[model samples]
Target: MTTSATTNAAGVATERSSRRRGGLARPTGIPWILPALVVSVGVLYYCIGYTGYLSTLKWDGASPLQLQVGLENYARMFRDPIFWRALGNTALFYVVTFAVQVALGIVLACLLHSRLYLKTLYKVLIFVPVVLAPATTAPVFRQIYAPTGTLNTVLEGIGLGGLAQPWFSNGTFALFIIISVQIWQSTGVVFILYFAAIGQISPEVIEAARIDGAGDIRIITSIIWPSVRGTTIAIAILSAIGSLKTFDIPFLITSGGPTYATEFLGTRIYRISVQYSDVGLGAAFSIVLLLLAIGTAVLIQVGSRTREEKAGV
Candidate 1:
């Protein structure tokens, strides 16, 4: 009886000790993460604040002589035709790349999910482009689309030499190439996303749909597409953000133009800031870019939510 009483008291003390440890753990964790929080929130927000302040000044990146020009840089951006053209290009690029990549991704995802031969090899091949560096592949693509390159060689071999032209010589063609390159580069990511999303769908539901005389297209449209709508929304947001700040491919492939024909906001901001030394204008552009990205993400999310709410999902 004495031993039992003693054991009960010991158990109560251990429980109290654990409760004390649990209570202290969360407070102690803040100190451990304080350094990372400071670096991320403190240093990052400082740069953004500085950039906002600098946007009101007209100063060559190096010169100390500064003119205070409130919103003049922004006004100049509004009047700049190149800026509008870049904005238009971004819109078109987003539409084309997003549509093509999503469709291709969905198709590839379905195929990969099915019982196919050499599945691992096919996945690797499909994903290879996503892993490749744009800087390395840009030069290769430039050569291929050159006047005397593999594309032209293939065209001539097929007796379609008339269609063979220097693909980068024209603005239209350059824009097309940029869009195509973007679509090629990002499709794998979309495929993987859809693949994972589709995998989560209940197999029983699919089988039931098939037994109900639903064809492949019917099953895809009625069951699978709706199932992966969240993934599509996410891809839409990402594609919007990506298209807004696209630089590497267009810059590396064509240097933003045969005449600024393929310019995007990212490349334009870069050239303004570095090449022309228009730091104020560049800062303004950067601010606009940030706003647009955030706005787009919010819009897509809201639209998605509205649709989901209407559908009672």
Candidate 2:
């Protein structure tokens, strides 16, 4: 009997020890995420830190990186009038595009949400641009905006020939035209996002508001806006970042000309680095663009958080 009891106690202790060892061998959340963490750090260092290092050196593409300028590129960039003009253009583009897109998106979403004829067809038509490649669309727009292109033809056909000018050739109109094309291509994305956001809202709540004798404007202002505020904020930030980094359309169309009228940071960087063989200056410009984008995003997030806090959200 004594021997059997001792054997049973030994067996229990061994079982407990094995369980503890198994627990130690099992992976935790940190171990599972370590690979992702390593990759992210490597990418961030290579992209951001390496770019920063390049910005401090005066090196062309084919030559050795020998000249250490130490912020001279940034100093020259700030002193250049072209840089300021590009910055202004970028700011204007973001403000106008963001405001128009948001307003148009909300209006379209609301309209499509209502009982309308051929709603599905309307949605498909509006969303077609979102799926189309920018490379495909930019060339088409370039042709349309040419001196004797479809836009001029339409103006002449409608007896508005006086309003038609050399769209891409004129400095005054080139930036506006680029902004319009950007808006045309990207508004659909914003509209779809807002439409989906609105769809997620509770239908019963809206019906309750209607039953309580709330007007359409009141219902929208008090209910719809509050519910979709987060979506609106997100789209606003994205639009700002995209506008700041705008390149494809403006580059493919105007090439940042009629006399640098449509010059933005993205195009400027390419021109400086590839066209002029000033990689260091280009790196500095890139860093500035990165900072601008980060700043804009941070500002929007802070503003949204503050608004939410004040509203008791």
Candidate 3:
């Protein structure tokens, strides 16, 4: 009886192992990837298609009577002054943030890659802001820029009290504050990416440049810049997308206030959907935002590729 039981157990284990092998050795591999394929095609695209459908109707999110409005929402969006202002803000924000972050990130990354003192400490300091949540930091920024906050106090102590005023009350100043906050929070990510790209460079190539009497700036502009084109293109796409969907800091700090100066597509969408309870208008805005983000990324990528091909890069 004991011998017969051992033989049955061994046979069962062998059968299970062979079944596992057969599953992995399937030629098509369709079953292995079906879940992800379903998620992408089924869930993701279905939501997107549903949003497109919602954009064509006028509904208050919970109402059963969804009036078919066709393209009226899009037309209203185009004619809306606040929408234009938000679009302009996004454009300006993208340009300024992209330029400043690129310059600062590249310079800092290069310095850190060299024989700089306290490299590890500097790296930690630089990256800490990236990990900090915007929700937590937004209140801090609001207080600092408040009319009687630390900034004004410091200004008074330094005899620059004459320049101290309400920073967030003015439209232009509020927008500037938003831009500054974004740059502070996001530059660390840009720095890390540049640092990694720069690290991949061959030490021998940099040594050759040094031996050829190339200064730091010369080597950076010539060798390092061209080599990191891929990283820069990636950063550009990310910046474009982030700019299109800017909401957290602006909504928390300025609330897109001071006469809609800091309004963005994301903030507008939220206000329309929740505050106004116009889900259809919000859906239209969201659809446009999605298209713009995708289009901007494609334009940047294609433009970069075209330049590279033309220059034989």
Cα error of candidate 3 at position 89, Å = 0.4
- lDDT-superior candidate, 1 or 3: 3
Best by TM-score: 1
Model 2 has an lDDT value of 0.91
Runs with alpha carbons beyond 4 Å of true place in candidate 3: 1-25
CA lDDT, candidate 1, residue 246: 95
Candidate 1 lDDT over residue span 48-85, tens digit each: 89899889999998998989999999999999999999
lDDT of 2 by residue, 39-59 (tens): 999897678999998899899
Candidate 2: how many backbone clashes?
0
Best first by lDDT, ranked = 3, 1, 2
TM-score of each: 0.92, 0.90, 0.91
Query: Which segments of candidate 2 are over 4 A away from where they belong?
Result: 1-21
Looking at model 3, residue 53 earns an lDDT score of 93
- Candidate 3: residue 26 Cα off by (Å): 2.6
